[model samples]
Target: MTDYVSTTPGLYPLPDWAKDDLSDLKGHQKHDLISGDESEEITAAYEEAREEVIGVQQDADLDRIVEGQLRWDDMLAHPLAVHDAVETRGIVRYYDNNNFYREPVVQDDLGFSGDVANELEAAAELLEADDDLQAVLPGPYSLADLATDEQYGDEAEFLGAIADFLEGEVDAFPEHETLFLLEPSLVESAPEDGLDERASEAIDQVAGATDADVVVQPYWGALEEKVYAHLLDADIDAVGFDFVAEQDDNLYNIQEYGATDDVSLGLADGQNTLVEDPEAIRDRVEWVYDQLPVAEFETVYLTTNTETFYLPSGKFEAKLEILAEAAALAEVKAA
Candidate 1:
């Protein structure tokens, strides 16, 4: 099996060049650039920024680098490449004004758009060119969470369509050992009444669609086994557990679920500036290693739970430095 390590959770800060372009666009109040005809100046700026990030990864000696998610706004924007990927009319309120939610729109019959497919192909090419890096695509459950309610009538149908779309995208990128990191951020907000059943059904529908190894990541809190039992049974390759949130300690129950599959130890805090102690993180990894073989340790990817911290560029870079340091320490200790 191929081994991997994430630079950190969320995105790396946009390099100076990218920032300059963004500032220029903002100065002109050009919010529509991302969707409209590509500006030569803007495209050049994006390339310089991307090259700088890729160069940083090479310099760091990091084995697997992320495209740094410089392209997509966030996981929600992943499917935006598709024509009318979402319906603007029916929107769901997110946790706060900063985060709004929408559902994915599926036509009367299941259909995939060439625009989305082409965009994904282009994204794959961008990541593939950088031989040192691997790519991560948003998982189906998270995509469903962001879609508008009017899109699917029922969540299952919406999620199933997402699954089918993702399956094709994964197939399209056949050469790379890509990790389809499923971010189920909305699972935490399920109505108190039937949260478990709803979460399970969503996970099952999406997990069932992909052939590539899937990693189910529940970022905000501990994942109740009952809620993720379908993922476990669906033969998911790994489960990413966040250890930074309020109830992170609850992840200890993961041991009871079984250590046979990959367990991504999400120890780095993506939201805070507090640098994590490498020794402390190593201790956590060691605990898991004790239960599983060192060879299996490669399956333990370290990352943050969410990417909310990425909006402001400066903070993002600080987090990246911390992650690089922590990853280095983990490698030394593991060695």
Candidate 2:
């Protein structure tokens, strides 16, 4: 039987404790926290929030646990914005979503700031001894696409520099079970114009920087063959495809590509407000599995297509519960 592990793409809904004064704190207070001016009240509130979310995931019996990314105030651009070499530019739409992120402008050579590593370490302290912890970060190509480049005028040069910069950041990450490199730009824009090969080389640099298993999760939708096949060149452990948003295309891609050593099948829709019943979710997973080249993969991960931050707090737990139950059901059915 395949090891059908359940996990998330990180950036969970903001905990309730941090939501009370959100309107008042939207501008200045948020800046204060991001700039390292957090107050005692804010610190305590986040701690409680983290613990609560962590407890929820633990209770759901998820195989891999994330840090909840409560401090990722700027979404995928947060890590870059906080880097000493990058500057926070004007707000820009995050991919096709209604959400926005402060575009990080590369002003100088990039380097690791140790922020994510510290956050992961704190999360490790809160987990049980036997729990398997995982860390998530934006992939190099995606970060480059999100940021404005001033230091490096050329795209190829900028991409190479960004890869090296992300390598340093990954080096700082604490030892974990897996490192999920979220690469939305790769699929969202579809590099059918021959940019896919260059992206493959850059992706290899970032993934090779880490010793932990690296899973490239392109969340928006299915990738074209040019981009998807290039992923085979990258030295990553698993490739995640979103079956929720692009089930038809994803299934087609999987069948065409045959399969891989491991696959992370995104079943839950994090963007939608409607929560799914566990039985329905189980059936969906089973349907996807029926089409999958199961013999080609040793393990499969059940997860949401994107980050859960888009979800309302009240619906987050239900989604996770559904995911957990579906994972168990899928495993049983496969057995």
Estimate TM-scores for all models. Answer: 0.76, 0.93
Off by over 4 Å in 2: 21-33, 294-296
Q: What value of lDDT does candidate 2 attain over all alpha carbons?
A: 0.81
Each prediction's Cα lDDT score? 0.54, 0.81
Which regions of candidate 1 are displaced past 4 Å? 1-6, 26-33, 89-110, 113-132, 149-151, 191-213, 246-249, 287-298, 308-315, 321-325
Q: Which candidate is the best by TM-score?
A: 2
Error of 2 at 119 (Å): 0.6
Worst 10 residues of 1 by lDDT: 29-38
lDDT of 2 by residue, 102-137 (tens): 878889988668788888888888899878899999
Report how far residue 37 has shifted in candidate 2, in Å: 4.5
**Model 1, 1-335: lDDT tens per residue?**
42436544434567756766777765654223244245777656666676666666655555465556554433354454333444333344444445433333444444554433344344445553545334466656666566544555766666666667666655555343435465655345542335445545555555555454556666777656555544466556777767667343444455555543566766767666665665666676665556543355436666665653344655555455555566667666656
Deviation in angstroms for 8 in model 1?
A: 3.4
Candidate 1 clashing pairs?
102-146, 102-147, 102-148, 103-147, 103-148, 104-147
